[model samples]
Target: MHIVLSGYYGFENVGDEAILLSIITALRKAKPEVEITVLSNNPASTAKTYGVQAVNRWKLKEVSAVLKQADGLISGGGSLLQDQTGMKSIPYYCGIIRIAKFHKKPVFVYAQGMGPIHKSMSQFITKNTLNKVEQITIRDEASKQLLVDIGVNKSMTVVPDPVIGLDASAFRSEWLERQAFESGYISVSVRDWPSEVNFKQKIVESLDLLARSGHNIVFIPMHDEHDEKASFELANMMSEKSLVAPGNLSIEEKITVIGQSDLLIGMRLHSLIFSAIQATPFIAISYDPKIDAFATIANQPNIGHVEKDDWNGEQLFDKAVDMLAERSSIEQALREQVMTLQSDAQNTALMAIDTFK
Candidate 1:
């Protein structure tokens, strides 16, 4: 089957890239002969990286032509329907599905994390578009609930994030080769979020305490320069030394880096997901509901939310200390959850493609 894949692609964001990777991996494993074309912002990079045919997502004629020849379109495994990211997000993704439907092709909504769709127009359009799609698999219960709240009445399957399906056994990172990592280290994944609170200061203080207690800190940036800059800013404020992961590490490499760490303090959603995929102990600081949702799945502590001005340095440090001491139990708890989610993610891909059958 010829299927066109769409999402926030060709962006250097490692989280979205990992979603694309996991989706492609699962789909190809389920149907080896499936022909895949990606609609990406950076078509050449997307094509070269994933070894799939690619077209510019913003090019309407090109997208329409591609969808016309394809059997189906797979529209997302990310937050494509949210107004929080931007006003255009919901329309852009919904528009793709509409174009596919216009060409008499089935469109599968693949493991999207829904809403913060505050605008009525976005909600109305999303409800209409998704209700018409042949099939959908959202990443969590919250996403499913959001769709229901927005008036999408179709039967939907709620699965874990596709990235949960990545196999860490085969993961390898050349970046973590050192004595500090050998003893034990913490991995942090952070991003710039708008807030008046000094959440950064609180975190810096917390990490310093952890460092003084003899734990090494390693900052793993999930995106390109943006996350790297966030990491650098945190590291600079930190009195103790910290190592920052290079900007060029691939998605697999970032997962590998997290896997090697004793604990992960994650602000990015996929960073926590990576830690869970590896069964690594983690502490999630929620900047959004999606972070809290995934934290519950991982069975870890979510210290607080950034936007809510809920940064507690003592609580953050104390929780990290507790998680470190109870690492075995936390890992034990996550193993079953991670395995089940992985299986669900893999099966979700099969279910998505089987819509055509």
Candidate 2:
């Protein structure tokens, strides 16, 4: 089978890259003879990294040509369908699906976090485009509810974030040692939010408390430059010393780092997902509904919402301490979910691939 994959690819964001890796891994494992192509922002780099044929996502001619040669297109595992972040992607991704439909090929929506899509135009386009797909596998009930509310009554299933099924054995524990970082860290994954809330300051204060208690604080950036900048900014404000992990770590390396953490207090959905891949304990901070949504799915603590919670981030430190105390039970809860999710995630690929028949 030849499949053309699309989503927020070729971007420097670690979360999307992880999703790409997971989807590619799932597809190949489901059908070892599968041939893959990617629609990416940076086609050359994505092609080189994943060892797949790639075309610039913005080049409609190239994307159309690629789709013509493939068996089908797989369009997500991320928040690609939502417009609260921006409206451009709804039209862009939907347009790609239409291209595949024009070729009379199958298209699958793969485990996307589909909402908080408030704009009427976005809802209209999303409902229309998605209703036509062969299958729609969303990551959470909230996303499925959003799709149903928008009137996209398709064959959809809610599954765990596909990254939860990512092969953790591939994670290189030696990579962290090579970077001269210690294990058993309190790994933190964070990003910038558009709100005026000073959540960063609150997070810094929480880390400072953890650091004072002799726990090593390591800020793991999910995106290279942007997250590294956020990490440094937070670390610089801390009364106690904290480390910003070296930038440009591969997806596998990032997982290794998070997996080895004593606890992860994270904002990025995939970072928390990384923690789950290895059964590490975590406390999530929700900048978006997807963050809290995954936290709930993983049975972890989500201290507060960035926009609606206390500016002091007192709950973060408290949750971290409590999670540390109950690590054994927490790990068990995560393991049960991880086992089922891994199977479901793999089957999701099988389901998508079977659509070709």
Candidate 3:
């Protein structure tokens, strides 16, 4: 069967890229002969990276032509339906689903994370478009609740994010050797967001404190272009020596790096996801609700809200110190949670693919 997969693909965001990889891997496992096509921002690179037929996501004529021949379109495993990022998000994703429907193709809304859609128009578009899809699976309860609030009463199953199902055994790295500068390290992942100007400085100050306490700090840029600048800037501000990982690391490499860390303090959702998959204990900095939700579900502490003025260096330092002291127990708890999530994530794919049969 042929399936057209759509989302924020080819964006070089490691989290979204990991989701794409996980979905394709799961689908292939279910149906070995399945043909997968991706709608991506960078078609050529995506084609190379995922070894799938990729078309420009923005090119309507090209996308419509592909959808005409596909069995179904799988919408997402990320926050594609949310307007918190921008007004265009909901319309863009819904447009793709509508086009697939127009071509008489089945569209599965796969493992989506729904709104912070505050606008009436976006809500109307989401409810109407989602109601037409053949099947829907969301990653969290909040998403399902949002759908219900928006009047999309269709049966929607809650599944873990696809990244939770990624097999970490395939990738392994020696933390000390790879980093070369630190014997033991904490993995820090950061992204640029519209926050107070001192946020970055505070993060650096916190990491510096950790460094003084004898933990080497490593900055991981999950999105190469967007995050690399933040990672480097934070690294530069630290009084203690730190390293910013190279931007070109593959998903596996990134996961391995995260797995090897002693602990992770992350702003990116996927950074926390990767930490969980690898059984690395993490402390989340809540830049978004998704971060808070994942932290709550995984039963980890969210140090503070990124948007709130109360998040400061001292609070972060205290949290890091507390989590570090309880590392062993924390890792065990994360592993147990991840095991359950992995099973659910796998079942979600099987259920979605079963519709094709």
Summarize candidate 1's per-residue lDDT along 1-357 as a digit string, tens digits: 988999999989999999999999999999999889999999999999999999999999999999999889998898899999689998889999999999989988999999889999999999999999999898889999999998999999888899999887987876665433557889999999998888898899999999999998999989889999999999999999888889779888899899878899999999999999998999998888899999887788899988766567878999999889999988888888888889899998898789755
> Model 1: which residue pairs collide?
none
Listing every candidate in turn, what is its Cα RMSD in Å to the true structure after a full C-alpha superposition? 1.2, 1.4, 1.5
* Cα lDDT for residue 205, candidate 2: 85
Clashing pairs in 2: none
**Candidate 1, position 344, lDDT:** 90
Please give, for residues 1-357, the per-residue lDDT of candidate 3 as tens digits: 899999999888899999999999888877888999999999999999888999999999999999999888999989999889789998999999999999988888888888799999999999999889889999889889989998997899988999999889879655435557536689999998887646788788899999999898888889997899989988878889888888778888889888888899999999999999989988898878889889888888888876787778878988999888899998898889899999888887788787766
True-structure lDDT of candidate 3: 0.88
What is the alpha-carbon lDDT for the whole of candidate 1? 0.90
lDDT agreement with native, every candidate:
0.90, 0.88, 0.88
TM-scores, all models, native as reference: 0.98, 0.97, 0.96
The model with the greatest lDDT is 1
Candidate 2 local lDDT, 288-346, one digit each (tens)? 88987888888888888888756465667888888898998888888888999999999
